[model samples]
Target: MAEPILKVENLKKYFPVRRGLLGALRGEPQRFVRAVDGVSFEVYKQQVFALVGESGCGKTTTGKLVMKLLEPTDGKIYLEGQDVTELRTKEEIKAYRRRVQMIFQDPFSSMNPRFRIYDILEEPLLIHGIGETRAEREELIYKALEMVKITPPEDYVNRFPHMLSGGQRQRVAIARALILNPTFIVADEPVSMLDVSIRAEILELMKELKEKMGVTYLYITHDLSTARYFADWIAVMYLGRIVEMGPAKEVIDNPLHPYTRALLAAVPEPIPERKDVIKEIPIKGEVPSAVNVPPGCRFHPRCVYFKEGLCDKKEPQLVEYSHNHWVECHLAGKI
Candidate 1:
């Protein structure tokens, strides 16, 4: 796969839960919230590998871990074959950050309202010491703005975050990420907050950027439809675990895991007959608390085809069912 730009193995992030005063007096054991648990995946150079699941399924947490925004409790993260997870020195982290960039979910929240668009874009280059002179920085800023399709860059360059629409603000965010000329990007639901029509425009811009710049993307989204459209490969996540992964079209057209099938069924279909053909696998009940996960397979409690003994007692390993297709489900081979 052209030597993966990023590789994550058994990544886990656990947030501690403090006990109450009384429990502390009794010496209660520390409890942890497993935000991301043992997630393993790879992003090949220039490939858009998406991690998708319902909100709080650890997709965003996984993205943060990959970006090193959150320190993992266990496992390793390798960037360009270097073990970035253990890099403690400031200079090492700074160098790692330059190669890997993140595009947050909320454009409004991520952007600084106080700064002008030019300042926002230039800050990264200045921090990274990319362009030396004012003229050089200005040139890079304009190029970045234009790269994200904010035409006649000068018009939008001096404007503040409040001056632009949701979509325009997001373009600026993307431009900021691209200014560093990063090889890998973690786009965490980049289009979820924008208008429906504007979402397509932003996604198209990302696709173009990948082609022109050879940028690899870890596109994290709950929207299976958009994942199907933008990603070269798709990984179906459920309860902090990847239930299925394969080529985007193969996964969408012929889903293997029950959770994957359920996600695709929820996506609105255009044709009436096709809609009927797509069975709606109603995911009953809420997602189980990560602290006290189900016994065997995490999805067993909510899975429709779940058998009492097997699914509830045996954890399933991700196994290859066909060429390039992998699924983690008890019924994968049986079906």
Candidate 2:
């Protein structure tokens, strides 16, 4: 296997929940929302690794941790085998920042309404010191527009955010990220807000860009259907922990973890025979508060196969089931 372009080990992020005046006076223990608790994964060079889970499951939070948008409470982040988490110097961080970029989920909010598309794409080039002059930046911006397939580049370059459609706005976002020629990108649900018809086109464009540009991606989304089409590897996240991960085809075809199976079951299938196989894995009650997570397995409360003593008392470690296939479940081998 190729050496990973990005590696995350025991990554964790916890946001402190402040108490009100009355509660503060009572001296309530400070609580933290465990947004990403001990999550670990790797993205190989030029690979699309999809992080999938329902909302509030910490997929977005994990992405932010990778980009250093939100600093991790614990654990180390390595980029190209360098320990980036320990880079404290201003110059060190500034140099690291240029190699990593993010494409946010909401295109409308991510792009500035005031800035025209040209300025939006040019900003990154200027910030990164990629272009010395206005003419040089404009040339790069036009190339970026063309790369994302925004035709005639010049026409779309002058327009504001409102002049473009949802998909077009997202293309601009992709262009902005690519303007610097970043090695790795964290795409946080990049196509979720777009029209269904245009979703495929955008995904295709991204895949094409990967082939042409050799960019690695941490593709975050709740859409398993898109994961099936795009990701080379899949990691199933549940309540801030990755429950299962493996080759995209193997994991999707033969999901080891119950949570992984449940997620795949939820994906709509066109085949009539396969439709009958989609058994609804009923997760009783809502996701428990992250502030006070359940003991042992975080998923035991909703897992059907959860055994009382073992699952509730002993937290299962992520163990490899086969080459490149891993699962975090007490019943992994037994199942």
Candidate 3:
């Protein structure tokens, strides 16, 4: 494989939990929420590497850590061979952020309501000092707007975000992220807030941009089907750790971990001809709290294949089965 454009090794984030007044008076020790714990992955240039899991599974937190939106408790984040986690100065961080961008889940909230579409798109270039003159800024802004298919840029340029539809607003968001011509983008559930009818359109637009602009993406989402369709590589996270990861089709069609199988099973079946097919509930319990994670394998409490003393007593490391397929379950192949 080629060298990764971005890499995260042993990434960890622990948000401290404050104690109540009584607990503080009693001198209780401080607690922490292990939102993201020891997540490691690599994204090669122009590849869409997806992190998929249920809510509170730390996939979003992992994305934020990679984008430098949140500092990690312990880990290393490398962007184009530079360790961004070590960058402390404003100039260093500013230079590093120019190559990395993020498309948030909520399009409405991501953009400022006070600014015109043109201003929103031009802000990045101004901050980066890309366009010196007004004409240059306008040209870049229009080009970016057209890149996302918001044509007749003149009409949309003067208008505010409220005048646009949800789909159009998302396109503007994409344009804003692209105006800087970033090498890598972290799209955190980009299409989750859009209407189902337009979700495919937005996804296809992003895929097109990836090919046309040679931009790699870290697609964070909980939808397994979408991940299977949009990502080149898939990593299934469970309770702050990657339980499984491999090529998209191999992981989706031949899932090895119990948690992965459960996520796949939860996706609504689209086969209308197979109405008689019986579905099995793979997982039984709720996800555990991050502050008080299970002792050993986090999935043991809800896994159907849980063993008496083994799974509950030992934490399994991600082991390779086939060429690139990796799973963290003890019975990966045996089951």
Give the alpha carbon lDDT tens digit for every residue of 75-183 in model 1: 9999889998889888888888999999999998898889999899988888888888999999999999888989999999889999999999999999999999998
Task: Give per-residue CA lDDT, model 3, range 22-69, as digits (tens).
Answer: 999999999999999899988999899999999999999998888888
- For each candidate, give its TM-score against the true structure: 0.96, 0.95, 0.97
Q: How many residue pairs clash (N, CA or C atoms closer than 3 angstroms) in each of the candidate models, in the order given?
A: 0, 0, 0
To one decimal, what is the Cα RMSD in angstroms of model 3 from the true structure?
1.2
Off by over 4 Å in 3: 273-278
User: Top model by TM-score, which number?
Assistant: 3
lDDT of 2: 0.89
Q: After best superposition, candidate 3 residue 80: deviation in angstroms? A: 1.0
Best by lDDT: 3
* Model 1 residue 3 lDDT score: 75
TM-score of 2: 0.95
Candidate 1: which pairs clash?
none
Stretches of model 1 off by over 4 angstroms after superposition = 271-279, 333-335
